[model samples]
Target: MRMMHNFFRIGGVAADLPHGWIDKCLDFCDYFFTGVVEYQKLITRNPIFLEWVEGIGIVSGKEVLSFLFCDFIL
Candidate 1:
């Protein structure tokens, strides 16, 4: 959890994700760590959650592409 908070602090600066998004991320992380929320129900009710997952994939793809070219150059 401490590592997650630190990652959020650094990553949030680069990502500029909205407060609501950050709140949801924290809530999801809390539930994940605590096992308080049922995974199936959360997924069924919150469609935005899928969007968030997709967005992460997009960001990660961009990062990977950049790194591939960057390594070639360096």
Candidate 2:
């Protein structure tokens, strides 16, 4: 299985963390931010992705209210 079950209890975990678990977890925490930065650099800062989203689907407050108040059968 991809994950473990019966590892959580109502109040706490089923048992103490395994040896080296904390170190591994700390390493993952360190790596996670780097992964997020890499993702942002590759995706969010990409020129092609920005070009696709630029000036698209822009809505004004008036337009939003018009849609929100428009009457229709539910």
- RMSD list, candidates in order: 12.1, 7.7
RMSD after Cα superposition, model 1: 12.1
lDDT of 2 by residue, 1-74 (tens): 74478877799887887899999999999989778978889787899999999899999887787788773422
Q: Candidate 1, residues 1-74: lDDT per residue as tens digits? A: 53544455643543566769978988899778775457676886777987667556355665777788985644
Query: Measured by C-alpha RMSD in angstroms, how accurate is candidate 2?
Result: 7.7
Query: After best superposition, candidate 1 residue 53: deviation in angstroms?
Result: 25
Residue-level lDDT for 50 in candidate 1: 72
Error of 1 at 21 (Å): 0.7
- Candidate 1 residue runs with Cα over 4 Å from true position: 1-15, 36-74
Model 1: lDDT to the true structure: 0.68
